[model samples]
Target: MELLEANGSCSNGSLLTLSCLSHRVVCQVIGNADPVWDNGTSGNSWVTLLETSYGFYIGLGLAIFSSFLIGSSVILKKKGLLRLVEKGGTRAGDGGHGYLKDWLWWAGLLTMGGGEAANFAAYAFAPATIVTPLGALSVLISAILSSYLLGERLNMLGKLGCMLSLVGSTVMVIHAPEDEEVTTLDEMSSKLKEPGFLAYAAILLALCFLLIFYFAPRYGQSNILVYLTICSVIGAFSVSSVKGLGIAIKGFFAGQPVLQHPLTWILVVTLVASITTQINYLNKSLDIFNTSLVFPIYYVLFTTIVITTSIILFKEWVSMTVVDIIGTVCGFLTIILGVFLLHAFKDMDVSLGNLPQVLQSGQQAPVTRDDKNILIEVDNSSIAPEDKPKALA
Candidate 1:
């Protein structure tokens, strides 16, 4: 008001005449343009953030339920693998197929299949955004169960690593650089037919072929990445295929007969291929690496590749603000650091509780400036009774 009064000469060439632009009305738009909250602060206010549709609730429930099942399945499968080893059968890490005959392993597979089905059903009621992030729950549940069930010791450091991974993943999901597109079958078909995506498909196939045939045969047992890379790289293609297949299925149900289209068959083929490869490698990774370690690393790497592939193929990732970009980079760093911690000292028995003992041991080491003092103490401790007195003298 003071500034307006100081500039008093106004209405000459504006849209409003003096009579129309009332002092009180104009002042509302001038300073306090937005409605203030009850606390007298200007910001986005909401009555309730939880006012979502019932379908969303259903989807959320399904996702959480699936997580528990999947998490438990991981342990069950691991136990089955251990049993297979004890029975003098070849272990999975060593490229053995003995797990197929194990009833316990079959049970785990069935349970995991059910969990995956539930997860897929979730996407029916809710968007991919909500369903995707809840995936970390499986990792958490698996980590918790592994400590007790499998006795894969997730000490204080491992716990911290898990926390970091979860936190980072949450940040990454929240601020993932993406814009929206590809809602319909036509748009998806177009995306699939694009030269860029075709190129991506070709390169991906080549890389995966090499990794699976050449690299996996050599390093599959020794390293986690060999198997996991094949899994992770195929993950993007799997996602794309799943989406395309879902669209085609929806069209089929609507009487559009999309299933008759060659594109639909292509999608079906791609989905089956990608899923087969993913499952095989994923199993090998779980068998070889610590379950807790594998979960977070796999989640992180899969998310990274999915995002990258999204950017390249679907052109979905774009237009992040400066703040969002920074958040994303920080989150990426946190995940990398978490994975590093999980890998680096996985064999070491170090935990946060070990810190005090280390510090105390460092503090307790006796120091002597004089060589004579050290020699006397040493002589007294080492020499016999008569020699001790003689050495002291």
Candidate 2:
């Protein structure tokens, strides 16, 4: 309005003439454009600035707090968690089974601690956009561990589906948008700077295991201990991977003073606690469900967690093309469905202990259709001595 009045410029070359330009309106618009920090206002406004300055800290803080709360709740609720180890040992007919299971759980927890340290460090140094995508490694690690340690069999279709999902995830990661800011070699001179990709992959694997153990039983109806053990290892690897990624990005190794680093301490402590809780909870859940049914649900839940974290927290997908997003989501969905199918076909009637019975019988068990045939045969053979067919009568 002031400019217009000074220049005496009005309906000369404009799309529409302002009926009456007012100085007050211009002042109001200008006032609204002022930055919050510059406005000199006090109160809750500082919260936003604080969050922005320490956004990475906030993310790791939330992750640790949430893990603690959840882990503690699980341990407190299921007091019979150790029973799972005993049970597994009894099933295996090895007196040392309990000791072995317990040691495995401990090792898993240690690995998880390492992974968490890496994860928090990574989060502190880089955006979650870069960190969370590394979680895709979990599936690969879990699959390998399940096959080798647990003797879980994967059919051709399941193997194919895993490969496809991996390809899709790789494409998504490769095409992901990168931040314009660059970090030079000298900045990352700390001990935490080593083992980037390997550490991140380990963290993803551990987290995946944790998720699978927690959710597989309610839906999959498979063995919970097997799933839990697998999940624990995966979770351990994921946390480790996260820490390694941080080191790699920053290119520094803060050796000798690892525990002194706040982020490192937070990651390690939270990760260990979380993995222990996960193993305990998973062991309990396996007693309640079959593994195949349980694992698929876990996968869906994990995908949701990662994708949600990626979008809302890091805005990883803002620059992604629609095709890439669709392909990634579809691939995840396909893997989930494939896991469900695997669980559904797993024989629920026969426990792991009863495998010999199923094999030695050498005949298929009677289904609903078989019952109908048996009834018909009995009726035909009996012939009630006087109630024969009408034609015979």
Candidate 3:
């Protein structure tokens, strides 16, 4: 009887072990069969929804605010330079680096830096297509400020440019592509390695090197195109670097160890170098050229390059419907037309005959024929002695 009971216990233990193994296998099969169990789709969908809604609006708001700050900063800097010139400082085009010590200059620099910081933060949350075109607002703001504060003229065409810029911006905002989800440094690195992006980067770098080393010294001061070329080409890369660093920063704060990634540091370095170069050349251009001319031309070139770079790197257009793409193109063309108008018609009020008068008189010619015709012709001999003394005094 004892032997039979021991056998029974052994058999029960074996049965229990088999039952546990079978249950584990069944659970594994069910889990494997379910597509959502480990696919990560649900999490991605949630993030996408959040980004498309509040994240986009926040970015757009920040960009608009940045435009105001940056536009104001440009005017302030110009004022500071003018003040320095009044104080016996050299002209900006004459290699006058003395603006460095001016308090107002420093203030303007600080303000610009603040605006750039806001723009940088904006990139982390928004698509570049939206953020970049909205930058045209800066041109409008600068034009307005130049008219009011700097006493620069904004002709009828410039006003039209401002309106077209607004219209284009509105259209772009409405049809802007959704922000691409970049959750990790590895993902960004992968995108960077794509053949299209790699080619674009190589071409940009090569062109920048040629412009800086060869063309800059020869034509930089005389030709507006030289400075613009350098800034716009390198600016495209800088924007990409900004986006990369922004993503790394976002990830780092989200409990990821993204700081340890090499790509993050690379992007940081690229952004600093690119921005410094851009500012240096931009200041040069501003110092030499008219604000109205510089702002619109820079906007057209920089926006074009940046948008092209973003489209290539982020593939923002891949998911867009054909209609959206067409609308974006139309909006962009409108902006280009506006810029052309600004450039072409900026001096419409100045007549061809007035050119010699302005040059000879060393002053702007009167805008109206009545003012020009009202010039007084004084006869000194005909004036009485007492009146002569009063007039002389």
Candidate 4:
């Protein structure tokens, strides 16, 4: 061991390789220097050199657990709404405050709040990319739960979609970014004020202003995307602010005097404004558009924008390998495809039970009346039926 306990600084101003008893641990390196390393142990083997801290795993676990809670909360909320309908009270869909009085709704809200709190804590420990894509898990959870809990039909495609989301999520989590650009509130403040982020924030705000004042007043009702777009755009800003505020919170809990810093207040104000805007516009979109349409679109846009913003703000992509990057993209695409299948075919009656018939028809090369009936049923399944939902409530 080097006897320089007073100063652990490296002479190169970046790297500090420590010689322990068994091996040398590279403690620090600048930028993307540490993400990948050729250890010269074997040919054609590239190892991802993560510091492998426990904090990252903690964040990942919290993010995953939050997804389950959030997913369950959706079922609870929907149940509350259904119960209100049974009681002959005003429904929330019609701007009624009756759901506020329902215990089930409050339970759902509290569950969601707990999930959000877990997610908030997750941001402090994990990279935004790692935490963000994991939201897909919540969608999968909701689909599965709704199928079982709410008596919603999940066709074979939906089941396949859930599986795809799982596989993709696993790939994404495995290849997710591990490094944090900012560790302390002071460092986070500097990152927030960086010119790149400031420009992004300015341009985003301008776009929101035009969309809200001009486009929304004129065409928002006609085109639901306008409102959803606003929600997605604002979501990017909200996520970044969440990261900053997370750092402030983490520092504060560690007995650091983060409250005195202007950046702490700045992050708080930005978080509140952005989160409020996102929720308001999102609620508007939900009220106007069918939830089946809103969910996939909002999730896709919100996640994509947050990812882009994270790249610019935290520079997480700076440490990514080409293979890891490709894996992440493929994983995200898989998740999107899964989400599309799950929501897009929610009302369809397609199932594994019909697979054999389809295969037999394909192999026999005979267009029988049974086959024609199957084709007709397939065509008719596309139209949504107006029927009371089978609630497990």
On lDDT, the stronger of 1 and 2 is: 1
Pairs that collide, model 4: none
Question: lDDT by residue for model 3 over 3-84, one digit each (tens)?
Answer: 2343455332232222452352211111223445222234346444555567878788888888787777767777777687
Scored against the true structure, residue 389 in model 3 reaches a CA lDDT of 11
Candidates sorted on TM-score, descending: 4, 3, 1, 2
Worst 10 residues of 1 by lDDT: 384-393
In candidate 4, what are the lDDT values of residues 1-393, reduced to their tens digit?
343334765444455557976897655443454345222122222211121346788889989988887777777877777687789886554456687788987897687778778888788888888788788787788778888887777778889999999998999988887778777766766777899989998898899899999999999888978988897788786777788888777666555667888877777787778777776776666556665676778778878888888888888889899988998889888888888888777655566787678576764322212233322221222111100000000
What lDDT would candidate 4 get against the real structure? Answer: 0.71
* C-alpha lDDT (0 to 100) for residue 294 of candidate 1: 60
TM-score winner, 3 or 4: 4
| Candidate 3 stretches greater than 4 Å from native | 1-52, 75-110, 146-153, 181-183, 217-223, 284-293, 347-393
Taking all chains together, each candidate's TM-score versus the true structure is 0.60, 0.39, 0.69, 0.77
lDDT of each: 0.60, 0.41, 0.68, 0.71
Per-candidate RMSD vs. true structure? 18.7, 21.3, 15.3, 10.9
Give the winner by lDDT: 2 or 4. 4
Evaluated at residue 217, the lDDT of candidate 2 is 46
Q: Give the runs in model 2 whose Cα sits over 4 Å from its true position.
A: 1-94, 98-251, 254-261, 346-393
Best by TM-score: 4
